[model samples]
Target: MLKTIMLALAAWFAMAGGGGLAQAKGLAPLAPVAPVAACADLARIDLSGATGAPTRQEAKSVTEAGAKPYCQVSGTIAPAIRFEVRLPLDGWTQRYLQTGCGGLCGNLRIDAGKAEGCAPVTDGSIVLASTDMGHQGMDTAWGNDPQKRRDFAERGVHVTALAAKALIKAFYGRDPRYSYFSGCSDGGREALIEAQRYPQDFDGIAAGAPALNFTIQNSFHHGWLAKVNTGADGKPVLLAADMAPLHKAALAACDGNDGLVDGQITDPRTCRVDPAVTLCKGAYQPGKCLTAAKVEAARLIYQGARTAQGQPLEVGPLQPGSEMNWIGVFVPMNADGPIMSGMFASDTINHLLFTPNPATPYTPQTFPFTLDMVAQEQPARALYNADNPDLSGFAGRGGKLILWHGWGDPHISPINTIAYFDKVGEAMGAPTRDGFVRMFLFPGMGHCSGGDGPSEFPLLQGLMAWVESGEAPAVMVAHRAKPTHEGAPLPADGPMKPPPGATGMPKLPMMPMMPPQPTLPPRSRPVFAYPAVAHYKGTGSIDEAASFEARP
Candidate 1:
């Protein structure tokens, strides 16, 4: 069946090594077997009190960072998980299977003797990462035992997809043919809980800005600041200078709906700004408008959750580059030191909101997380809620997904990932989901990569050139600037300036995805895919990515 889903997605294009071998263009190999037929003779994959080793690295910007190229291997698989296993030994062949989150998401530790400041483009491709799923310690009691929370959710996705296919067959002693997975915000909800509980693993999967109903987004950030962060003098009422004046009033009423104004809005669903447009059509304007308890806390942080008569809840989607912080950003707004930090606030408020343990850590919990505490954490939240739209186990083993999100993502809600990708095209129908799937969004971005459109392309080399060569992905380009960041915006101090490439960001031209409006909108009557931006009725040049039309 299509060469065993391109040898199970060339093992996640060895974890997006070197812009997946230059925006993929290979595919055709498959028949390679014996990846892990039930741990074939188990030689050694131990974990008893797992400690050091697994985080190994060697030489050069983890070798010219086409995007995610870093190298390493050999296991300590357990010496108590320390971290390391980035691949790509040859020219361009990244192999990845990473993991993180021990102190609010971040794993950029890159060492094997320093210097992987990113630059190896043979159209880069070689990736694999692992922080051992649940670690980076201080305390999360090594991922709250329940058999290490079902081995960090379903045997940490088939032991990092069978230990990066046994370290790419101990470095090309054989194996790799295709594979992919990415992250953003618990790594975009662990890339939709690894394509909804391992749909035959990966051929393609990218989930940026995904918080995936993680117990309804970290209990709606501790229940929306325990209800619009206090005060009629109660204190805590929205700080960080009230999120820079509501992100500068949502970029001054959605900056010209996308035709460019710079600050970015692109589309929070038809840029509808009515905080009553920061109101003032009459009196009672206390402290410069927005009151009625600050427009009911900006309408419960923009129409999310509701009940008790005010109805409407279940929400997601505020697209058009959903900006949620850019530089040195680590927002918490409060509930106790950066949202309690880790097994996501000690396994959602001490074992899924019942809160008990370590001899009464601040009691207050009669209880209510509910659907019976999600059926007692459905085998670790169904191995990370690939919220089941059933990809018939990765499309009856033909697999090829590639989902990517951003559209200004402030931690999750790229319209709950295009409404769970229109319920995965209504449970895989339409040409069997056009031979699998595709969902890029990007636009003036945020989490899992920056913003202001054009996001420097690579996507595990376009999902490993569509898992070895059926060549699926059509559009991918991406890039942004402003970098020069190394402590010097201080006239309060001023004078340092050395990082936007020490000197780089300049690769402009490849944008491709937002045509729609200006008459006959909604995806602008046919453009289908690949590095988009159509219209060449002839007379040449729209700056060409090999001359436009990656689609209709």
Candidate 2:
């Protein structure tokens, strides 16, 4: 039944693509092509001028029930970069897709992030590939070796694209008519790198929640949060139980700013509610009001990293509506160990961020939050930072870039993405920037997907429409998963809990569930391009996308 539904969706999508906005504008639809080389022959083909002696490990036809047949090729780029490429044996679109990797990528994953609704991917009709970013483990120790560091920084993604396209040509007997890249988080950083450094690699790029300012993000921002939340006893000053009330207060103050009290703040930059307002008046109230120390800690975190002169060190601070997701990062589950933020900061500072590794590793509490510390990251900045805004070459070649970020993202503040977008406009006149780049902010969404607002959207579909037919996306509908139990939303507390034998807090249900049953269609809302917001239309159900329209 599921297969039948997917097949039906695929057919419908193909028909829709045939009559897309491009067709309405009298543009021709891209035609599908056929492969010329046998699957096994891919292993013998050589990639000229490609480094790491690109060697194909296996090339075989993959067959599955109710899905299109495709050639799956796994290979290694010299010195340990692993990648996988999949090419459809039939109904091949004259297009190629390359996916980005997340956080210290050590495994090859070919997901099309934010493009799950794209029929070509759902039906295995497009050529797709992804690399492990030239490393084998999540540990930053690989950065100690200059070659591996270069691979993890920028070389990996670039070389992988070159090799994948070569293989695609070998298998199809022709280069793709168009190519696209999509990624979120660290992958998002790679997408920007491609546009900035290797403009001709892809025709369109989709980046979400990008770790663009790598040096500051992994060091200063994360370290600051870790330091502020840790007490002298080395334990988290803010407890997991504290998140619920804090989040509740934040919503009460700012969730209705967009003229609709729908449990999400449309733009977090507009949220100015201070967490200090929830401080206890006299005696501390558990799970209700914050203590003085906790209040101060939360204040520092929300203000972000700062210099002695009170200047902002990072792009932006933690957002207001993202309070619930801070439990694991700012508040730890264990009593003694470092929190998630500390681990990320320490790994980068000790192994990768600086040129000569620190003799004595800086703990989150010990890392100096000073101008000198910021200067210390310079050696590795060129390799890791993708903050470059100049994309003249890419834009000159008609490359389209889509940037999206979740307004409620607890990791890598969405404000940074906005600032970067604004910088792009400043660098290349707003009119020119608008012609090739578009950014979308998803309200109520977490770092990547889950949150109170709709998160899922047809990002690739929108990108393809823009790149292939010159139709820029104005608004895209994003869907929220059905609540496990309709009308009873899931609790907002993150996955952080006190250790056994701890007291004073009730044991919260990790995941609330209900007996499986048929359910109504998911709620959806329209997400507009930046500077435009969705306004409630005052008509149909607020849960439906049709009930909202984009307002500039």
Candidate 3:
């Protein structure tokens, strides 16, 4: 009975003391009680061979940055988990961190656990960050080593959250009321991993163009980088050069489907143009027409990653509408068309996929995962497969998950994400899935953050609002025609096409990349979670989410 009351008092202290300014008397005091029991080492977080100077300061120093006073902190070890705590001056804002560490995440730059630069954690809320996912050398590597995995209990992502929260509690003398997460690529997968395994970790999450399905996604990259090429005698090269004409055709077919065709296509599903027909037959600028060989090259991309048996290698959607970037001259895609640069698939095969492991340095019996054979290998399937469909933990904790992918993503496919979401609906049923989960398909974007559109929106804001305020993100605006879309960085030679509907259409300040939806005010839509389907009036089988109701 005494312990229960103490626990309840602790909860009150956590929320009321987030800023460490609470004056409540009933709440228990916030402090780390080093265990009197000697079974565990509570002095510091002891890691393998971990010996070093502790915190920068002999004593704790609570400093403030600008208007948002914060708790600047470092763990007991010299370079132990370093972080900053920013608390809102308003009606208490929640704290969260966006993670980016993968493979061997070591250098803990003050960025938002994920973003490269220090994410000032700038917002109307308190945000936290850390870099303890292991990895010490360049790039993410420590994540795969068994010894390191054992030290971490083979669950690195979980530690990111656990450590972050611990830091928050210590620095601010309080616990966050609502927690949220947002990230892309490796970060994206981390977001979903938390939802599936630790639903109570974050209340709401936004995973953009996630590099989920670790094994297959990376493997597929290897297969494409190794197999696809564009040389006269079947050599590997990037498709940038040929990508121009391909982009032109893709736009021609799917541009105005959304109502406008300035140069973007919102719904890539409507695009069915085949670049094969648009090859060198026509006069395309001075010596710029597509050759028969180049035409075939474009066909391969649209076909996506494949395997030895001619079976489709499962993949995910590229960020929505990300294909218009023919910028910079190189090979099939780039104008310079350097041999090394052109072989994108080859590069992936060598670097990310086939790169020899230096730790053991023993050559694997099989080195490359050809698109045709990617699925056959578990390691290869990890790259971008998105196969982990279960999210019971997230559902049980009332965690809201929002994932969006670009239909025309050139780098990563969006179809895989769609497939994963579909499976979630099936497993949990439309009723539950519809409430906790939702996916927004961007018309033209790339990878996770940028491309030929307005990739930056109030994504973090929208997600935070949903988790903290009970308001969900129903309408997300992604424009490929942002004023800065012209990555002036690329040489003028870098090819680019007008956004969809740019076809002698009415002019608007914001370029029309695709047909516009009804100029409707912000709309409210339910996020259909898995296990529970959105019951609706439809003429079809009700047993399956696909047949039971129509997606709005």
Candidate 4:
């Protein structure tokens, strides 16, 4: 009895003495602890073989909820990779999140883990980390160095994950209970790489609009679009204004296919409007109708790239509602004489794929796109492509994967993701595949975000529920943000931002700036897994997600 009383007194003293035992063990304190170490002190941390030199580390406070304090650490990983990690001062959820970078990944922006209405740092409790995917810039010049190219292809993310986990352990005195990876586009590719190459890295992964078929997607697919749209003078046959009539004709034919003329095409595969219908019967008036050349361009875009024998080249057709955004891919820029996709494809092909030697590099103008060239590039394709169908290792270890794609994506074709999902299903068998993977297709959404359909949804929450609770997601509820004029301007006066990254980037030329439509209320819907479609029940308001049912 005396010994028990003494032990009770000791516990009481520890709690009253400002977390005596907890502080020593690096555990959560009984009371809020002051900043343990200066942000700059993080630079002094030894990562064994990995070198980290801090660029900046500071105590920052966010204005969400109760003004949470955090340490924002920015540094360079060994060689040239840049990384950033955010550690919450209080309310650490014992979870770690690593966000992926997009488009050549030259910047060191960390994505806020926002999905399914939960923000990890602000709304929830999770550590966040991001990296610049080795080297810098939106250009492929980094590909000149073989080591840097390999790092960007795979190593950078793995190193960042390991480094961030070490830092989190040091800060909290305990390793995270779970680790997650979230990204779209190029980041999506990173997510798949983590699953296929480093299956032990993340417990859950959310990949949206992944450019898995890296080589052919940027080279052959973009090349076909450029070649088919270019005139004999090497200029674009179609202009931005020329797209309205085509969009209108397409909407008139297919918008009501889903029992609603709501300006969004629910299923583009069934939409078949003849491009020749847009051809002008009389002399062409600019913007009134398309010429023969323009009509041919539209047909080729909708049909997608093909071999001389009419074999589909796995590139997706441009959806009917995607007309407005084609300027970036189909229209020529005055300065470069090529569209955005053309530029990306040219750099990828000449600099990365077919670099005979750095001193004597090939140019897009001189590169040939024959079947022989495609066959010759197989080795490079194998190196860059993330289309590996094997996910048994990840699934066997109980890792959960959630994939999403916008049906009307103007950049990477939705077909590519669909093809990959199908391939995974085939390799793992339908039952086993369904056990670990789920893919959601947004009807009118474009690229990573935004479209006529409800684009904003919480994928992270769904993933968490699946991973933690073992409750597989059947449908994800999505919301369409208020139109631009209702809330803010189209470009919103900020730098281009990733889904949860700081500062918004410029919208692509083909990305439409949706105007205010007071007539239509803000809409919500349910995006279902593959083999399931959200069907209206004909009872509640069409704008409410509750009005739909996920039916297989």
The lDDT leader among the candidates is 2
Instruction: Go through the candidates in order and give each one's C-alpha lDDT.
Output: 0.45, 0.77, 0.45, 0.70
Q: Per-residue lDDT for 321-393 in model 1, tens only?
A: 3423411222233322232212233435554332233344321122233445445545544544446666777
Models ranked on lDDT = 2, 4, 3, 1
Root-mean-square deviation of each candidate, in angstroms? 20.8, 8.2, 13.1, 10.9
Backbone clash total, candidate 3:
109
TM-score each candidate.
0.33, 0.87, 0.65, 0.84
Model 3 residue runs over 4 Å out of place are 1-69, 74-94, 101-121, 137-144, 147-154, 232-241, 282-287, 316-321, 326-376, 379-386, 478-552
* Per-residue lDDT of model 3, residues 512-532, tens digit only: 122112222221111122212
Compose the digit string of candidate 2's lDDT tens values, residues 116-143: 5567677777898888877765557887
TM-score winner between candidates 2 and 4: 2
Root mean square deviation (Cα) for candidate 4: 10.9
Candidate 1: count the clashes: 87
lDDT of 4: 0.70
Find the candidate with the highest TM-score and give its number.
2
